[model samples]
Target: MATAASRSGRRRGGGDDEDDRTAAMRRLRVLSLHLQDPSPSSEAGLAPAACAAAGRRRATGGADAAAALAAYLRGRHRDTQARVFEFFLSRPDLQTPVEMSTAAHRELCFRQLCALVREAGVRPLSLMANDPAEYFAVMEAAGGADISLGVKLGVQYSLWGGSIINLGTKKHRDRFFDRIDNLDYPGCFAMTELHHGSNVQALQTTATFDPVTDEFIINTPNDGAIKWWIGNAALHGKFATVFARLILPLQGKGGDPADMGIHAFIVPIRDLDTNAVLPGIEINDCGHKIGLNGVDNGALRFRSVRIPRDNLLNRFGDVSRDGKYTSSLPTINKRFAATLGELVGGRVGIAYSSVGILKVSVTIAVRYALLRQQFGPPKKPEISVLDYQSHQHKLMPMLASSYAFHFATRYLVDKYSEMKKTNDEDIMADVHVLSSGLKAYITSYTAKSISVCRESCGGHGYAAVNRFGALRNDHDIFQTFEGDNTVLLQQVAGDLLKQYQEKFKGGTLSATWNYLRDSMGTYLSQPNPVTSRWEGEDHLRDPNFQLDAFRYRTSRLLHSVAARLQKHSKTLGGFGAWNRCLNHLLTLAESHIESVILAKFIEAVKRCPDEKTRELLKLVCDLYALDRIWKDIGTYRNVDYVAPNKAKAIHKLADYLSYQVRLVAQELVDAFDLPDLIIRAPIGMQSEAYAQYTQHVGF
Candidate 1:
């Protein structure tokens, strides 16, 4: 079963008989790497040219590899876009001590971060480091809407707000934006209440209009109704966009406050000159967070407070001079929908943040893989961990995913780019869907990648200095903050269901008709058998079959999700209705992400130009596709793409990936655009570090 007969051809390395076998053979070598013992190779057998080539891919040669990466990036994707992924990275090797010395961690981190931002000209990203001025300028420049600086305003009820948050109109902007920029009135967004966090409709804060004085009396009726967990509220913010029930006299036309629904009111919390709480409002800090301590968080309490009638944020829904609540939309729910839509900015921001986190993680892991040596022989030589199949198995697929998601993020941002300039509602709605789906996928994945990279580093991974802990802390909120990943996935599923409903109503004579006709058979078809099994890429020389298989499974999975969701909706109700709906839609969102990422990654591989790099990555993509399929192997059992021997076959592809990546890790991580300091794991730092350490340790 395991025969190895060389063909009568001039071959540089071994290959399996079939394309899938050859592909799987690649994966096997990659995984076998993890099982190897730790040791340095004193004597190497490969020729100089081959070793040099391998070095470029593996990070065995530092500055030279980085330079080559810069050159490669200048040509790939956008001809002018530099692969500047590593720009935000700081060295991961230092230990974190609570108190710092003159030349401590903080100073070193700031120096590297600012330098990367300045050198890369990525001003939009400087916000992560809390450069207040640049953060807002780019947000406006990007035409973004109400967003947050990841800080909430007010303690006891001082109010929560962020720079990214929207100020209702030119009036609100005139009144507050300048104060924020000057740090005079930093704020918190008071949308969620203790009683209702995700369910905005259920928030208990209230604003009852006092016709006697032409002011709104904002009050926290009880403890359950109090505003809580507001970031930036502890110290910085001076105002909050408070979401409260808008209670109107039954005779008056204000939308029902009890059922009057939630409305955003821009309320001032502290008197600017004194920094003291307003007469009726109280604030308390949420002190010490798991991460993101950079922003102050707090709680809020409001007594019967008075704010002018004009303070109601009513661009979408308004309050008249007499206290009548009138909205541009027909119903309170519709008006509420518009209000909630602004939160989409948070979704987009989180997606963008995920990109930042992943770039750093991959950089560290790949660089380490290239520098860490293990197993084989001091005479014959073991290999860089990059050459181990499992190393690439853990890191490479995620690399491909990063590429894919990057494209999707760019696509979403471009759409937002167009929407903000034109104020297009349709574009905004689509962006809402995209941001929701992407926020869910990217956040969920970045969390996973963090774990992977941590484990990839072994025991040393848990060290706080490496940034894994900090990155994890900063990003953990991503899963629940902007929106819970589970909930966002459900929303995406709902959007997909809505689309299906619209298509259904389009009948036999609309544009929907044409799409149905054009897509035709394949849209209604089953999984492609060749793609399901790994045989298509059994041979090492030709790779189209492997590529095609990846495409085939991705297509099948998406279609399957649609069909399943459509079927389940017919009978489910109540919790089941929501759960079934959510489950099916999550599947749809996952598939969409998978397809987009695979397509983009392949595009990247195609652009590599190096015959070997392309060939090797093609196999890596195969492994990604195969592993993806195997993950749902239980679901696709009836389908051709899901089978057994192929799993074993694909596992071998890991071996090939491990071997190939040894030569490609440098190139791959370089494309990530990380700086050397941030990638400071002894293994990830430089070619000399590995050599120096080995010599120092008497290896």
Candidate 2:
């Protein structure tokens, strides 16, 4: 065994070698010089004067640029966000408490939600129907204030009320819309059963038509049929948009009823006046969850609950008093698809709200990084943690991702709005696929990124008051609700394969899938040698190059997965092949979503009217694209699409861009326009973070 000094020397490639020691000391001296000034001196490997001039040129336009970028990021709903955020700021009671019991948190969340509706006058239904842009903006603002409050509001308006608005006819809407808007009818969306969550088509709950009584008898056939994880069901919800298999009574006696497939029905779960559980409904608390204790998740079971015939949300399918079921969709599968399609707004809302979470988390982490300083060169002031390359690598890319997701989710919201306005089947289909993909992709990303943010903040982050714990716990369920990320990814994969097959039939592809048509020939071919080897900063920064690389990866994955499935079907059967290729299918779906996000980010950057803001966004876009490319360089290398030298260049460029982004990281996070009131973390304060944090921790 060697002594400690000898071991360290060996680790540095020179055990007891004087020459090596000298070289190492020289290198340290140069590094110290660079760290001391960081203005590109000769020791820092650049001409000081010229680089200093360039640095001045590249300096941020300060608050103006941040405000302009914030405007762009807010899209068409800036006024809504400003108003809502101001309202939240004014209401100190709405601030999330540092400590509370589950019941207390739930009650507080509910009261805050009521205040948003009654005091703030946020008419979610009206906004959704007339101004979806403002609707999402309000949701995003609510989420930024408190994740639980945002989710509870979403369950009330987007899921429960939206089901009535989109799936129900005028009668249903008239009965529920005003009540829901005014909080007179707090409701639950009772869709997910204990045993069959993602597989909605296989739900075991039944709603039998009683023609004689002119009512539908809803029942939970087994424990597995109990509606699980239902928001507001534990206490407040008076009604639910219950989804169950519609069973039509047979014409003759002693005959089995006809199962008319799944349909939505308005079922009363509790007494509105007294807030008591209805006669045939049983509600049980889900107990403590990892996060989001404020949402009051509960299990609901219906035992032969009876409701009038008109309770059925029959926009797509309806049953007559004589027990005749009719639908314009013709088939059970078609009707099921259409009915679920109407609820796509839930997924869109999840995606939008997930971005809100990302913004808040990133804002906290980046702000903390900017404020907290650690080691520095001898005889000099300590440097911010954000100045270190390693720190920048950790937080800057994620910051860029938060920005990327903002525009991506915004695009999803606009597309959803367009689908609603046009009601075109093709647009609806596009929205469905897009919403599912974004919901899964963005939520999962935010969930993981929140943890990174927590760790990036160091020991103080572990403090409950810092909010990482709650943010992580509350956001964890986003990946499972709306739809499980795995199931949703498979859905996206299935849609991609459908598009691939349709492309072969010379069908006109939707805007989202049109790239598949070109992928067959253009993307499947080997890369040109020149393009493969090109590794200049300008080339790597080009949006076209970034998008092309993304498209290539997605297309290649799509093609390979399609071929593999085709080949495996002969031996394994269709379902077996799909199971065997499940991992690959998920990869394909993720790649496709990444491509779409990059395209949207590029489009958003182009649409920026402010020159300074556009420049900043372009830099952010480059960081996002290059960072993703570097992470997936293996895929490009495997396909020979990127040469070895190019890969190395990409790695270097990504690091450099991370540093570049770190320079304006504060401005980027400030562009989120989050008030200190909403952030609520002493460590993430805008000024005097150390003082605030010490005071907060009782130092």
Candidate 3:
């Protein structure tokens, strides 16, 4: 279908020059592919561009489409305008007052964020949109209010399982629902201990059931057992969903919660009126953290804190007045999974935020590269820095990434929604693993991508005026909170290998299975038809036109390496027995990341409506796929055999691709749904001229 770009002749905002031509070429390739076959997805099975457009159409027709359209169009225009005015808004000319205050900058950013939050809140997609308690009364009334209100509160418990409900019996939900919406109370979820992070089995805070008084005594055994690093608990929160071991007089469980395991209780952290610690409660602020300063993090310790025995958050496990411990879920792992499953929402939130940050980064890099003049211009003075081959190599792939992550986030969001529906314990376990794994990967990618955006912006990127510095700080903690990346990655790897090993038969057929899956069509593989077609001969031995080329060869070569790993795994018994097979596991995870990215990049190119946008995105995707394949030529190849000449040629192409993308950076950023104020960078807006900034900043 001919994508009917608007009559303005500016379907995408930018210049008309050599850079435009380059971007156009890239787009034509993608558009041609889409024209050939207009299926929902590609050879490797990712959704095609048509699907995106179609989705957008359905989105507009949704029940609240009018409201969503308003939000989308406003955000879209806001972002585009922000990039256009990057120069003046950069604050380069704004003189620093003698007193030196930053009220203007702070207010500018806050207002921007507030607008963005409001924009997202009003979107048609219920999951994507925040269900504000004030706006959606039923959501609040049904106890689902926490889903959106929790995000709105920006509370310290970013992990997602927090409830305003006093940790009483499941019966408490009845009373808590009405009062919670009324703001009669506030709360936090305190599960992690100072000693162990991932290992929840080791918490030491103890809750002793006193059958005599019907009041449970919750006490921290030592300083280590104290609940440290609680967020809203520092100020806003009136109570906490505290995790401590349960001790019963009848049962022989020791004072150590480990014997009874961790049980959650509603413990009052502060006297709401005075903001003072309730009796026997000691609280302090965690001061500052690496990121997410909007939330007030805190430290809390309990010394014989007393609460009614009914104060147990008994959704999972419960205690009766008789000091009996009972749980709806039988297995301890299931209960544990339920406890941690609360983080799933957090993972979803981070995933959404990560996409936003990536889009912002791409916009800044592309716009700056386009307008910031450097090197030569035809007869008319210096050219835009985007003309530089080196520049394109840096920014284009990341541009491709912004698109890819958007799609991946869509798939991930759907998966999380499904996870929420199933009451099955087994399904919940899988959800936990999937959510944790994807969150780790997505957050890690966002962190890395944001840095690349910074570096792409050059010296300007390093400045807070560019917004990357701040966004980088915001994204930095994603790796640690929820779950540490390394730890989470290991867990993901473990889960992957576990699944793979379960099907491991006596035959070492990993290689055979992979090869046949492609040739015989048993793989049920994705739409990456080319990657599926590998020769029996090793890829390193071939030197055809495609092999000679870096990007094409990168995907092909990795496929071969992946084939080899599959063979290794099939032969290596269980993953546990394969002590020396860590490398294979690592590559397996990495290969999937490459596959998803490749699919998205190709899909974006195929489906993008604009001729220029499609062309620019194709090159970005190609460059990205190649960058991954050869990033570590040392470990990838047995010898440094890639001729320096061939390497330079590939780099040249990557540079060319980057240049094409840089021209359209402003347009791409605009599509990301950011408001101009939130971007808060001089080069972030669309309409500003470079000269204005250079003159103002004395550049």
Candidate 4:
């Protein structure tokens, strides 16, 4: 029988003597190198010097600075994230995709995720707490490793669990929160209908209050009313928090049931004990999707399901024993906002997770670039692809964005933490608007970055073992689900317009809304080529200048779109006019979001504890800001925001910044602190990747 050492040697392509000789040669070579050195320096004495030299070469302040930046970027949840990564690595069952023919693998993955949640003592209602940062950190880490698992957890804790915490009263929380947290009662969030996804107000599903039985009868009146894209509904969910139009009949003044608008209710979906589908709840699997197959998304329908009146998540709207509808808020729209506001947590969580995934993509691509060398001058050693201008162009801006979004997410999480502590109307509106816009912007950017990372790694990135396929496929849904990116941007545009109108009417503005005031003064004045012309690189680097340019661009877009909208509305009414200006509306929303990210990024960089970290990150900030400006150069150029020469300079500066960023590309990606276990991609292992490849498969 072959010995263990011999088997290992055989796998690595060797024999016993060859391995021994090779080991002896390695030791001899090290000894020779030390003997050959003329310096009297000890190994420990020389280590710091070597690190410092490398840091200088990388242009990242030094090793200490790089280390500080890494720590800051890894965040406060590193210990928890490390443990999660280790736990995932230990379980082979969790590492690979299961075949679609049998959902048993998906079920296994779900069970593992549930086990992790149970151990964490975290539930969806946890988001209601002022500090759910730890839980969100874990979710973001998990998402970076496995998108399906992260999304499943989000469905359980943020979507389904959060709805109960936000929309339901104490009675509902008492009945369900603990069980849901413990996985004793699995649930799904049912909101999107077959015909209406983004437009919840137009949903056809209804819950009619029956005075006779004192129950709310839930019904999917038509096929279009089927609740679609519901996670865990096919097999796992025991109940769902169903959003439907509330119908309460008046005693005398009634032609049809009084429309009480959209409301949420907890309806049983399956038998908790038998794990069987319940009566009146029809469910069918949505089958294969572009990604996240581990999550059993399904379409659901209710056929006159009678749930008790108390089933309503009535924190905002409630029905008395006599079937009279009453609400704490005066209007239905206010109630809808209050109830659906629970989704803000999910949106924020997605933004964090999106940054996390982008970090992984950047990490893999950067590491692979460093290890995989290509053509060089004749009779010279091959150079790293990362040294190529085009390669740097492909990745460094994305690298900068990964950092920008990282800081932006931290700021958002902190700001949201404060907002949850108060009931201030203005702050809440700001939070809602920011969360929607950031979610749309960050997810879309991450998706594009993932694509770039995949292409950067060439053919290896396309392989499942390399992890980019999974990254691209799983995250594709994020741009559509939580809130469709386009639809969410519209919300941002509407909120901005409201603030713009308020400021024009001389209403007071909060700090975040101060830009709207600035907008009225700046964009409303007129176009001036000389005034808007771009200055030099020094001027571009000025934070105040960047802020002004961003604010001006956003304001100009808003002003232009609103003006066009007014013209269309005069002839076509509000909805039709809005439709006509949809493209401009999207641009307006995106520009506002970009400006907010830049502001937060600058603020975070300023607060860096280490001078070196701050200096290095400032360059990253420049790259992020300038790259965004470059993308919108046409807009700026068209509006005379910059001279033609300045436009040319902007393009040149972007290339130069990309080259500067390339010097520290590895260090920047390393700041994310993703472990090899989570990264999984062999190419991501760098030099060892090739060795491991050669060892396993003969070259």
Candidate 5:
């Protein structure tokens, strides 16, 4: 019940060295009790009164609670995927050193990847086809072990193998599935060109159909059309799932060929027997990246590369031997959407993996805070860094955010899995918008969170052995790849406008968008005086109030952005108007995604079956909601939705909630269940942290 200042003041009073040491040991013991085995038999190691207190703590929220929460966070596949994570921990050979050259790191990552498949028995094709949840679970575990290994696996399986499964027909699958599964046909995804990254429809690489030879000639027409940053292409991959403009030649005239939009093709870039770059194909290593050097990213250029006609991944669109184009989709735009839609699993994976990175980073920061001691009252033992409000302020909210994102990304994964199963247009549309928005939202948040965590750990975080630098470098590309965060946000905003129009037209809204309709009356009404002035802790923490505030901000932004676009379009026209309002559109998109995350987090808390665990989660949720609302208070206050006094109260409440969360920070991170071997940072060890860190630094 004592405040941090009071605790420090009490320690400042005179005490012998032996007394100070004893007090510190006692505090460490109490703080670490939850890290011990929570079994009743383990209590025999403690005194009777201590054992009784430990029993009470376990009943409230302890190791058992952490285990239950971990299971819940892992979802239905927790048990099935346990071995996947354990597999990495058991193999010391799979672990990369703290330092290595790009070439050496790439070779090590490749060897580690092979071990993951051959020894660990990771069947990505089978899991993705039959068990998507398990496939993602395995991916999270792999990414937690090594970002480079995860990216390599994603390129080979999720991008290359997935293209065959999702975009190609049975014959294409029959030809390549076995080879890809056994690692015989190493491959890369060739989508981004030098001139175009996210603008897939504008990519200039051409796949010209040749009816005479019954083949497709793939060519990079100019320097800008060369495929760039392709993983596994420089030395490892023998094939690539190439994205290009499918062209049909004119029958008699030779003016121009008909461009049938962007499509994917199975193009062989290297020889199978000798691992040599094939004729007319040029591959160059994208050397010395800032991070993820373990991934062999390369640039690919093709000059009149020819492949059989059947190599086209033609589930959505196809061409005949007679040079005629056919597609189930009615128009090029719809076909393009469908083609890109099939690959959305990549975004889902990135969003999920970003959370994994945050979990590890936050875990290290929080654990180090608990162990590292610094300034305190003179003549007293220095207090733990976590005891300071500033340290808690920096870390607890992020810890809370890690939990919030855990549930939100879990929802995304489940939704993606459902979309794959039903193939419902509505679900597909929801998944597309959801994936893009969450992918941008979560990755950007994590990118910032990693820096914050690294700074929170002070000098130790700067050391390479602690992993913050590598984590930052590897994760930095996540926001740009899959889709650029900026462009992806616009996609979400564009969809929001479409739904807003659909609401006006009296069309039924999808489940995710139905909130748009429900919030119409609330958002348009004048601010409620009573609700605006209510600033008590209960009011601030209420799920209803938090959700309403989030919903109101998004709805208001949506309406205002729509009106601005309409007004601007009258003068500037559509493209110009959209460009003028890009900033507003991004805010609207981010607001909408934050609302979705909070809604999902609240729902997850309500669904918890364990009362003690649920109670702990509710506190974390409160911190997440209030901290976000408090940060954006200016937005709420400008509209008179929150009074000055209420704004102050929200800020104080957020601070208090952070202090509360810090009390159980260890238990919260323990639920992530990362092992020491996987964590790899000596300073983040559960016990003997100082010794491990000293040994790591060669003291």
Candidate 6:
């Protein structure tokens, strides 16, 4: 079983091919077991028992709790996602990793997934279309099933296809859109370089226009200029949306060769008929990633490659036959901004998918907790792990956070969809800031949640059968991809400061800006007075109190950081001043984002139609907001946001709310409504887990 990856890696002397092959085989062996369904009859035998607690445990019937939650999460698109999820899950071969461990296996699986998507009659390009409900439905379904598969879908749809649709003109669309939708022209978005990831302006790859031949000469001058981490590049990718600096002779201002900033072009990487790497193009596999090894991630380099001048994706800017560059944008920076703005959809997709992963992890951990029993009183018997105060403490808060993130991600997607139709720059800037902050916050939150979920499962979580390891490994990359979380938060911080400055000048303010404006005086004046008598009405369960606490903290932190930057920039220079205050800035960004999530969560809670659902969800919301403040109660205490005794009291209130949430914990996770096919982990099968284990040992 020498994988295509192994053969190609060896052929190119990539030196890591053997290691990749070994890892794939190892992963396949472990992953294959989960693909098997432990007797459907046995599975049917277990569900009633698992749901028995739902009937008697709390006000919301236990059996219906998960289904209700699922209904809420799936929203108007649940049926669509369910159909798509079942299509992939029904095929055991498609579910297994036998065709996903090596380069060959991954290529085969990638093609299969693409074929499945096409067979479903859902076009990848439709995602970039004005109405993106279907596109997001597919993403939610695929991501829930497998993260690697979801990423492969995103690469083709959101990145490569999106680049063409959003950045290219009519000529480019007519030439490629049909083939792209049909998967006849699998493509990669080539933007990140070896020496310059995240910092696209510093990329070194060059596309020099040759006026004599009316073509562009694309080149990778140094090793650092090579495009890296490009999905589908080693195999399967026939073309790429290449981002490179545009150099034209004597074209700017006077008689000078104009150095237009990074622009995208469509370049052929492989011969369409033979699937062979084209001349002057070289690719090497990025072998054995911790997760997502199923994608054919590869590095690419170009050497004096020539393409027709028409290959430029020039919706924003274009060059004439004489090499004169003309752009509708006023400056190079604006041009580049317009180009990169197309990628905000990709960021939105990643954040949405990250929430899906969080749901899966939490579902598995919660289900396993119900079935798993540890020591109890000697006279009684073993108690389910869900009963332990410590266990509830670990899993419940994360469960609440997942719900908050789910709603927040939904808010992000709606914003993105609306912005696509309008394309208003001011609205677009707000979308960019919100998406960056959210992508960073949600992915970081997911990573922590998955890790906690894994640990909550104890020894079983570490095993492959539980699937937490893969979820954690696959999800960790989200923190860096789309944009690095840290840098993105800084971008949010910068935007906040800019908005704050605008507020001071009496400029018109947006809703969010107005909220910040109204709060400025309170944040700067003094922390609110803490009452001598601690009232539960002013604590965790009170939405107004929660909102006030969050709003005050965010505004205070944001203003403090702004004041520091104002004073320090005088002597230290702009970059130095910001660098010195990076921590405060990041804290400011995080607090702002947390406030936004709380606001969204509270609003959603108010709109819940079911009284029981509303009541329970409000408790979850309380846990989310209060736990957030509990973690940093020290800061609130220091600033008199809460008196020291009240700060301690709020911490106690947060812990008590966690217990309240624990009473309906099973129903809480069930609200996510993940199917067993997606849950995959054996421990999540309730009584079926014990049956499968015993049968395996021939008991």
Q: Per-residue lDDT for 549-581 in model 2, tens only? A: 998898989889999999999999999999999
Query: Which pairs in model 6 have colliding backbones?
Result: 4-104, 54-62, 66-670, 69-671, 70-671, 250-256, 250-257
Q: Estimate TM-scores for all models.
A: 0.74, 0.94, 0.67, 0.88, 0.91, 0.89
**Predicted structure 3, TM vs. truth:** 0.67
lDDT of 3: 0.52
Candidate no. 6 TM-score:
0.89
All candidates: CA RMSD (Å): 9.5, 4.0, 14.2, 13.2, 8.3, 15.2
Model 2 residue 42 distance off true place after TM-score fit, in angstroms? 7.9
Better of 3 and 5 by lDDT: 5
**Which prediction has the highest TM-score against the true structure?**
2
- Compose the digit string of candidate 3's lDDT tens values, residues 1-699: 344565345546566455678888878866544333232124324342221111111211233432332243232123333432342245433211112123333233333323323432222112222321122122111111111222333332232123422224456656554434334455666776778666677888898888899887998888888777665565566778788877776576464333456777878777878867788988777765554444556777888888997777777787777767788788777777666665465565555556656666777777676666643422434445544545655676667666666655555554555555545545555555655555677778878878887887778777666667667875677677667766665565565444444344332223212222232232222324343333222232232222223323333433444455566667675553334555555555554444544554455456656554454455545556545544644432333334444444444444434444444444555555454544546776555635444544687
Question: Candidate 6 — which residues are off by over 4 angstroms?
Answer: 1-60, 98-100, 252-254, 530-534, 693-699
Pitting candidate 2 against candidate 4, the one with the higher TM-score is 2
2 or 3, greater by lDDT: 2
Candidate 1 clash total?
A: 82
The runs of at least 3 residues in candidate 2 whose Cα sits more than 4 Å from the true structure, single-residue gaps closed, are 1-18, 26-60, 251-254
lDDT of 3 at 667: 50
In model 5, pairs of residues that clash are none
Sorting all predicted structures by TM-score, with the top scorer first, yields: 2, 5, 6, 4, 1, 3
**Which pairs clash inside model 4?**
124-157
lDDT of 4 by residue, 1-699 (tens): 999997777767757668788899998766543332212223223221111211113543545656677887776767877877777777666664423432864686576677566654444345445456777887886776567778888888888888877788899889888887777877899999999998888888999999999999999999999999999887788889999999987632656668889999999988778988889888999997778888889999899999999999999888999888778799988888887675688888998898888888888898888777766534545557776667877888989998888888887887777777776776777778888999999999999889999999998787776788878988888899878999999999998888777777878866565766656678867666664565577887778877777888998988889899989999999999999999999999999888888998999888888887887888999988888888888988877778888877777777767766777776777666677766767788734786664554457
